[model samples]
Target: MIDRRGFLRLGAVGGGAVFMSGLYGKAMAAAGYEDFYFVQLSDSHWGYKGPANPEAQNTLRRAVESVNALAVQPDFIVFTGDLTHTTDDAAERRRRMGEFKQIVGGLKVKDVHFLAGEHDASLDNGAAFHEFFGPSNYSFDHKGVHFIAVDNVSDPGARIGEAQLAWLKADLDKQAKDARIVVLTHRPLFDLAPKWDWATRDGEQAMALLMPYSNVTVFYGHIHQENHHMSGHIAHHAAKSLIFPLPAPGSQDKRTPLPWDPAAPGKGLGFREVEAEAKPVAYQITEFPAMKG
Candidate 1:
């Protein structure tokens, strides 16, 4: 079922590809493992009008087209967060979310997932986000992997809160200690750069609950770039933004959006394609440019 042609074509356009995995290997597939993949588009920042990205309005629409053009459509699509830029008007917020929803609705794939970012939720504790997209935090089982969508941005404090932690604990207790688990969030769980508002306040607790599990990987967004790091045994990978790119963690005093390069318009803007192999429990992540320079 692997469409080699489509995969190659996508890679040819987008470029950077990286591979990540856990300790779980071939033995994990004894129970009928199935390989699957998904698309992750983050930080679209719809309705954002700034010099950082003049193509802000068209960027997301273009990304949708890019995914639709994929030779092999992913099993599902997930928007990590920051779907819209921050707004002071609640009505404007909802309007932006509405418009964002309508645009993405053009996708060929019917099953798409969304999460909240501080811009979309922190203002009113995810009130408008809930009106458009249900439950900020939830979990699901796909093939043989357990996917947990954590809502750290819902609380303006950047904390997952005690309640969600309890829920996560309860959920983890049900799965086998060695379950292949993937945690998706808008903010990096570990402290990547606290001054930049990239770290989750109580993310350590969530990691603690997941620590007992042997196979665990996390995919998050917020910093707006491709970054790879490890917290003990857990591996955290950050996704690029569909909007604009941010400076590396602590690289500069202020976490300002990098100046748009006239030479390469879409240089730092893109999405991700994650191919999951159940047998070896590996994730082949390919980063694709939202728009070519």
Candidate 2:
């Protein structure tokens, strides 16, 4: 059995995406402390009209409503990636981003962080995305944890080139030895499957840059499902999509968007709530689905 710290170390070497297994134990360890909670919503795919999810926009709206209705207002919200679907028309892309902003207008929390997925960046290498959402990569500290948002889906898909890697190194170097680090991006840093554009091109180099950090957690949204693994002390988590869920890698011959089942309505529209606190290092993840009514 792999321990939490050991699991993160293995993720550093093996390049496998890591997630925390003993969630209950970790949460219990941090009991009786002031914990901060943030919501992660991904793959909204605004302006997408398809049979796979006939009510995509409505579903997204429902998700925003759900977040606003939370008993404990989140510290902030993070839209991991895929804010809009790809299209040849630049105006269309901007329109989609516009719609996305409008949909989240109900967000009770003020600070909302955004990242770019391949669909949002690949068309013109994120020119429009950044124009509407600001920098694709940035870093900040909240409640003693260093959070770094990286742009891994830069052209060529899932490649965190030299410049970003250097930036990441610099960012990590500035933090204290024991500060908990949380890295967020659109693609998984591990090689979930390269052929299908699921894994980052040079994720191993990125992982090595994070190896020195004692407590690190990498959160991403792309595959449109929930998955967790461990790399040393670092935990890798993939979030569910607000648009639709895709089959796990190798589970199907081709990775395609799964249609919302009338029989299983409201199945895939959900988001992950992450809580992290200082001292003793703890995290609790709760997944919430959109309200059916």
Candidate 3:
């Protein structure tokens, strides 16, 4: 049921994350035209080592292979964030970023975008991340759809802050009221749970700015699982992580990594596909459970 395939039908489920289906198809699209689809990967946490994910490097490699092997090529691929695990040593961080980029460069998809997660922000307020991936916040338009990526995690307080908000407003101001907008960032724009470091301190301001748009959807990562929520007309969807899945928000007293289970090695981990050309965007998600090796 989780891997349903089709287009134009989207369900907005509740409880912290969003789940969507119908992003990838095996058969060729009808001649003369085709729908738009792109793959979303998040929380790769490269350079991480521990029992939580004993085979971290291989998992990342397999993830690339999985996307490359998709029967139909995704229009593009966007990594939501946490590309590298936290490393305090400046040189080490650069090394990790270089390696992460090198590995990801192997992806068959040519157009790839990256975002910065908290771990990536650990060094110099993400100066290192910028050094590796370029600007922390920006936007682009593709096939009449506007995509915006915000940096809400780098701030020590976990805030989108004022400058970026102004940039977002100016960017939105250029678009027509009916324009279709997709927001990409490292964390949810709404307060899923502030106590758990899950909510962006100033996200509400950003949400308020997007309210007037006729069609707006947010695809973000950080929760490390599938979640969906609606803010008025806008929909916010969360994607699963490649490195490891975190506990569901507020599910436990303390935020801790879900123990890597040999029996369910790939559970709660996967990628999402979005059908952007459809009237109402439809998405399909796949979770990878770790396996016994």
Candidate 4:
């Protein structure tokens, strides 16, 4: 039900289950797994104004259109982070956050969730984001899947800190070993590249807490590319951005944002659609280069 580039052709089933297509298909209904789909839209630098991406203002709208056009509507959408670019001015920060909320309000799916990105937190240490969205960290349950939205970007110097870690431990302690868990955050939870600001300081401790779970997947953003890693059985996957992309870890002399490539229009600007409501997630490249260079 999908083509060569790996897009999903949703095949819905009764009783909350769905089909996923990529190079292969998976029922995604094994071991008490219920099926549902969600979209991950990350790093949409809404207030950013620059030539790095001329379509900066329109990119988020384009991403929304793409998701709206999907054959099957996602049960919900999770914007991983970086909803707005950072600025030194406080009023501008509030303006951007308000504008972003207005933009996000247009999504067809009402069950949308937002998290913090360093860009959104770079000013006032996430006060603006908290005002627009609710608490930076929280958890929810849907269709047998337990999701934890951790706030790793709100604190300066990039860390989960001890208080949140304790809360995480208590939260996880209540869950049964067989429960499926997914953690969403704005920063990678490992030492991807500390020099490039891609690594989380106390992420080691957070990982230790999650290490006890048999089914744990960390879906994060900030790196803005399709990359994956593993800390033991836990799989860490990076979702592509709705804004411009950044270079690979240590790929350049310094970690600089890559300009929108006209040749590979969709090279770095797209959201992720996880089919089967879970893994194996069919991470298809979004619609063609949405905007011309």
TM-scores, all models, native as reference: 0.95, 0.87, 0.86, 0.85
State the RMSD for candidate 1. Answer: 1.9
Which candidate leads in TM-score?
1
Candidate with best lDDT: 1
Model 4 lDDT per residue over 10-52, tens place = 3222111222222212434355555566777888888998867
Put down candidate 3 lDDT per residue, 135-157, tens digits, no spaces: 98989877656899999878978
Candidate 2: misplaced stretches above 4 Å? Answer: 1-34
User: Model 1: per-residue lDDT, tens digit, 28-136?
Assistant: 7787668889989899999999889887878899889888987778899999999998999999999999999999999999899999999999999999999999999
| Total backbone clashes of candidate 2, pairs 3 or more residues apart or in separate chains | 12
How high a TM-score does candidate 3 get?
0.86
lDDT of each: 0.88, 0.78, 0.78, 0.76
lDDT of each residue in 86-198, candidate 2, tens digit only: 88898998998888887787789989999998888987888988888899999987776679998988565568999989988988889766556789999989888777788
Inter-residue clash pairs, candidate 4: 36-277
